[model samples]
Target chain A: MDRVRVVGRRILCGILLSAWVLLPASGWGAPLAPLPAPKAQKPAQAELGRRLFFDPRMSGDGGISCATCHMPAKGWGDGQALSAGYPGSKYFRNAQTLLNAAYNKRVFWDGRLSGADLPTLVRDHLTEAHFMLVDGRLFPERLKQVPAYVKMFKEAYGGEPSFGGSLKAISAFLHTIASRNVPFDKFLKGDKKAISAEAQKGLALFRGKAGCAACHNGALLSDGGFHALGVPENEQIFQDPLRHITFRRFNKVIGVPNFMNLRADPGLYVVTKEEGDRGKFRTPTLREVAKTAPYMHNGALATLEDVVAFYDKGGGSGPNKSPRLKPLGLSADERNALVAFLKSLSGEAVSAKEPKIPDYEIRKLGDN
Target chain B: MDRVRVVGRRILCGILLSAWVLLPASGWGAPLAPLPAPKAQKPAQAELGRRLFFDPRMSGDGGISCATCHMPAKGWGDGQALSAGYPGSKYFRNAQTLLNAAYNKRVFWDGRLSGADLPTLVRDHLTEAHFMLVDGRLFPERLKQVPAYVKMFKEAYGGEPSFGGSLKAISAFLHTIASRNVPFDKFLKGDKKAISAEAQKGLALFRGKAGCAACHNGALLSDGGFHALGVPENEQIFQDPLRHITFRRFNKVIGVPNFMNLRADPGLYVVTKEEGDRGKFRTPTLREVAKTAPYMHNGALATLEDVVAFYDKGGGSGPNKSPRLKPLGLSADERNALVAFLKSLSGEAVSAKEPKIPDYEIRKLGDN
Candidate 1:
C-alpha cells in the first residue's frame, strides 16, 4: 500500500502495454497453412476435358463455353458484378474463379453443389436452361457425329461418348487447375524475406487484431463453412427480368417456400430450406484474392481495399450476421499491410490453351 | 309494253334461272387441277432426308424433331389449336399440315418464307426461338459427329455434313410427299362415280355461289395469295404468360411498330412492314384440310362446320377482311355436302417409319 509499491505496479503495466502495441505477431506458422502441391491428372481425360471446356458446342446455343465466364486472364472470373448467363439470361451471383477450384470441394457461392461429385455439377450447368441447356438424350447423338470426339471419348472412358463420360472428362480437366509457385508457399517452407516487410506486417494484423484467420484460415484459406456476413444484395438480380426469372425458377426448382414473394437470394436456404440458413453463403477461399477483382458472393466489393474496409467496419448489418464478424480497429498502415499479404498468396496466373475442335466429315456409305 | 310481252320476258328469265340451278357443274377441271405425280427422289438422298426429319437432334434441346409437330398420324399437323413451341415457350399460331407442303410454294401462314427456297424456310423453322431454336453454327458440328449422318450426307449431297446440303436433301424428300389416291383426283381423271353425288353438288357450289374458287383454286387448292378473313384470336395467346412472352418477342423481332402495344398477331405484315398488310395471312392450301382440325391461321375455327359457319356469317369482323369472303347462305345440307367434298381431297394419311438413330463410338486418339 506504500508509494514505492504503487510506482512498481504502474511501470509493469506500461511494459505490458508497449509490448502489445509495438511488437509484431509472427507470420511463420500456426493457424494459417499453405496450400499443398498440385495433384497429378490423367493426360487423356484431362485433354478431352480441355477440348470440351473451350468448345461452345457444350452450350444450348453453342455460343458460350466454360471459358466464357471463367476466363483465365481475369483470374478465372468474368470480372463483372454479376455473371453472364445463357444467351437470354443474366446471372444473380458473381462467378467464382477456378484457379484453385479443385482445392475447394464445396463449389458455388451458396454451396448448393459439391465438387466431389463433379460430373453432377457439370451436368447441372450443362442442362439448366439458364446455362448450357443441353438435352441429355441428344448430346450423345451429337458426339457420335464427330469422329475426333468419338476417338477421344473412347480413349478417355474406354467406351463410347456417354454423357457421364463427357462430364467426368471435364471434371478431370478441372482437377488440373491449381495455384502455382505462390510466394506464401515458399515463405511457409522457411524462406525468409519471400514476402515484403510491409506484407509481413499485414500478415501479423491478419492473424491477430483483424481476426481474419478465424474464418479465412487453413491451407485453402477457408474453413469450408457457411456464414452470414450481412453482405448487401446487388439489386441487379431483381431489376433485370431475365435474372429475376432465373432466380425465381431456381428457387422453385429447389422447392423453396413462398418463392413468389422471396426477393433477395435465399443463399444456403435454397439447399437446406431452413429459415435460419437464409442469406448465408460459403466462406470463399482467399488464395488468389488479388487477381479476382470485385470480391464477395455478389461482387459488391470492387477492390481489395474495399473488402478490407468492409471487415474493418464490422461488416454489414443483419439479424443473422456472423458473430465472428466484429470491428477491427486498425491504423491505415496495418490495413495496407494486410492487403499486401493477400497479394503474396497468388503466384503466376494459371492458364491453358484451347484445343483444336475437329471438323465433321462425310464419306460415301460403306466406302470407308 | 303489253301484258303478254311482259309474261314472255319472265318466261325467258325463268328458263335461264332453271338452267343454272338444275344441271351440275362439270367435275372435269379448269380452275381446279389434279396434283401432278409425286416427283422421283434419289433413293439415297430421300432416305437421308427421312432420317433427318425424324431425328430430334434437329432441335436445340434435341427433344423436338421436325416430325414432333408434323406427325403423320395427325395428317402432318400437330392437331393443336396453338402450337407447342420450345420447352419454355408457346406458339401463338396453329401448326400447318406438311402433307402437301411441297406444292405450297409460299410456306407459313404469313408466307414470309418460300418453299421454293426450302433451305431458307427450313432454316427459319429450325433457328427461330419459338420453333426449334437450333444454333446454326453448332448444328453442323453436331451433324459431323454422327458417322451415320456423315455417310448419308455424302451419298445424298456428295459432300460433308454442310448446312446447305442437309437442307437440300430434306427438300428433295419433301418433293416426294404428294397426295396419293385422292378421290377428287380420280374424279378429275374421268371416273364419274369417284365422288358422291352430294360432293359433286358441293363442287358446283364451291365454284359458283360459294365463290371459294376465287381464292381456293389451282392444283394445290390455294391461290398462293394473302387475304384477311378476320379469324378470331385464340385467347390462349394472352391467358398464358409463356405464349404472351413469345408473342411479344416475336413481334419485336419482326419489327412491328409499337410492338409493346400490339396484342394480336400482325401476320403477313411481319414480312411487308406495311400497315395495310396487317392481319393478312396467306390463303392456305385445302388439300389436307380434313386432317388439320381447328382450321384457319389462328385455328379459331375448331371444325369444318365452324369454318363453314364463319364463311356463312361473312367471316369475322376486321378492317382488313377480304371482299371475297361473303355469306353463301348455305343450308345445313349444303354445308354437309361441302364438308364431304373437302374429305375427297385427302387420301390415306402419309407417314414414314422413324430410322434408327446412330450411337456415339469413341476410339483412343489413334486406336481403331
Candidate 2:
C-alpha cells in the first residue's frame, strides 16, 4: 500500500510538469502569444509610403507630418500625454502607437474607424480641420510639383501622383509596421529562459488571478473590443480654454449624441449613439506599452506601475465602469512582476533614416 | 625675343598661382580654411553631458531638451524661421547651430553673453523664463533621483550632482563639438580638385567682388565682430499678442534703452545700450551656412540666393545700416557659384545616439 501511494505521487508530479510545458505552446489557457508576421508588401510601394510619412509638406502649413506625433524614438507615439496637432491645436485623445496596428479590425481610441484598410483613416487625419488641416484636392498638386515624388509615385503605382495613390502608399507602409522577437514572444514560443522567473509568475497571474486576459488576450494582447475602464478626466483640458473649445467642437463635428457633459469625453458613444456605450474606448494593444507611456485613452496614468495599480484597485469611479474589473489583491512584488512582463513586450526599436525631400520652387498664388 | 616672351608668360603665370595660394594661407584674402580639432575631453564626462543634453527632465515641464531646437537631423538648428520657446512663448531670433559654437567668443545673435566658456550661457538658457524655465538649484535635485544619473555624475565629476557640475559637464561636451575637414577645408589644404569649378569661381568672387571675406573670414569663416546689416523686421511677431508681449518683456529684462517700436528688435543694443549699437548683430559663422537656412539675426532671408540678392541690393532700409554692404553687382551665374561655394562648407553630418534614461519611481511631492 505504501509503494502504491509513492508511485501515485510521482505520476501526479510528472503530469504537472508536462502541463506546464504544453500550456503556452497549445494556447489553451495562455493569455498571450507571439504576434504572427504580417502580409508582405512591395518594397517600392512601402518606400514611397515612408517618404510621404516623413514629408511635412503633406500638411496645410507644411509644418506637420505623420512622423511628427508617431516618432520612432518614442515608440511610434509622441511621449506627450496629449499630442500637439496643428500649430495652435491640441488632440483630445492620446496618440496611439502604429506598431502592429494593422492586426486590429478597427482604428482610433473610440473605434469610430472600422475595417483594416488605413487610407480612409489617413484621409480623415490629413483633412481634419483641427489636425493636419490640408485640403485633399489641393494635396495631389503639391506632390506633383516635386520631381522626385512624381518619379517615385510612377514607379510604385505605375501612374502619376494622385490622392488615391498617396493613401495607398501610406497604408502599405503602415501594414509593414509589426513587432516581433520580443522577450515575451520568445517565451511564448517555448523558450522558458527567455523571460525572467518573476515575469513567468506575472504571466500566470495575468492569465489567472489578475484576470487581465479577459480583455487583454490573444497575440496582440487586445481583444479589439471596447470597454468603459472608467479612466479619470484630464483636469488640464478644463483649465485651458482653447483646448476645451477644441474638444467641444471636435465632438460636435463628429456628431456625438450626448452633449450634456461638454467637459466629459464620451468615447464610443459618439459612433453608436447607444446610452450603454458611453465612455467605452477600444482596448489598446499592450505591445510596446512600456515606451508609449502616459497610458489610457485620456492619458491620465503616467507609468506602467500606475496602470497596473489602477487595475489592481478595480479602476476609477464611474457609473459605466467594467464589471470585470475588481480588486486584484496584488502584492508589491506581484505589481513589479506584472510591470516587468509588460515591458518585455517591447521588441527591437523601430527606426528609419529621414528621406531626402525633393526641393521644389515655392509657387506664389496665381504663379504659372 | 620669342623665347623671352614665353619665359615672361611662364613667370607671370607661376607668380599668379603662387600669389593665389599664398593669399589664403597668409589670411590676407582667404574665404575659409580648415577648422582646428578641439582639445580632447574625457569620454565619460562627454557621455554624461550627452545624456544631460538629450534628457528633457532638464526642463521645468520635462518637455524641452537641447536637442529640441538644436536637432542633429536639422544641422543643429531647428528648421523653423523662429523657434518655439517655453509653451506659449516664441523666440525673437532664429535658433543658431551648435556646430563649432565653442570657437566663438560671443554667443547669441545679439551678443548679449560674451566669452567662449559656456556655463554662464548654460545657466541663462536653463533659468531664462522664456527658454527651458528650469531652476538650477532644483534641476540637480531632479538628476539625483535617477540612479543612473547619480552614478554617471559621480563618475564624471567625482562628487554628488550640483548645478555647477551640470553646467561644467555640458560646457565640456559643447567644447568637443568642432566642425572639421569640410570640402572648402580640403580645397584650402592644396586639393585643387576638392571643390567644383563653380565653387572655385565663387571662392574668388567671395574674396574679391562679393566682399564676403570682409566680415566672414578665418578658419571658422567668422571675424567674430558685430555689424549692422539692416535685417528686415519679422511681421509674424506683431501678429501674435503673446509673442509680442514676450518680445517686449525680454528686451525690457535685458535692459534695451528704447522699446519704442515693439516690432523693431534692436539686436546688440539690448546689451550695449548704445545708440551706435542699435541694429548691430554679431556676424554669424558661415560654416554650414547652407544647411542653417533662413539667414541673418532675424531669419529674414529664406535661401542663399535671397541672401546673395539682399547683399547685391546693398541690404534692407534702416537708419543704422552698415556702409560696408555696397552692391556687389553679381550676375546670376556668380550668384549660383557663390551658393555652391557656401554649400561646400557643410561637412559630414554630425549625430549622437539618444541615451537610455534610467527609470525611477515618480515621487508625488516631498519624499525621501
Please report the candidate that would top DockQ against the real structure: 1
What lDDT tens digits, residue by residue, belong to model 1 across residues A100-143?
Answer: 78766578888988866778888988877667775554455345
Fraction of native contacts under 8 Å reproduced by each candidate: 0.00, 0.00
Candidate 2 lDDT (Cα, 0 to 1): 0.75
lDDT of 1 by residue, B1-368 (tens): 55376457545644544422322233422257667555567898888888888887677666688888888888788999988887656788999988778767688899988766777877888877668876554455456556788788878878767667778777777766768888887787677799999989888778777777777876678889888888888877766755665676676667777765665788899999887888999988889788889798878988987887788778987758888787788999888888888888887767787778775332112211
Instruction: Kindly report the TM-score of the first chain in candidate 1.
Output: 0.89
Under CAPRI classification, how is model 1 graded?
incorrect
Best by TM-score: 1
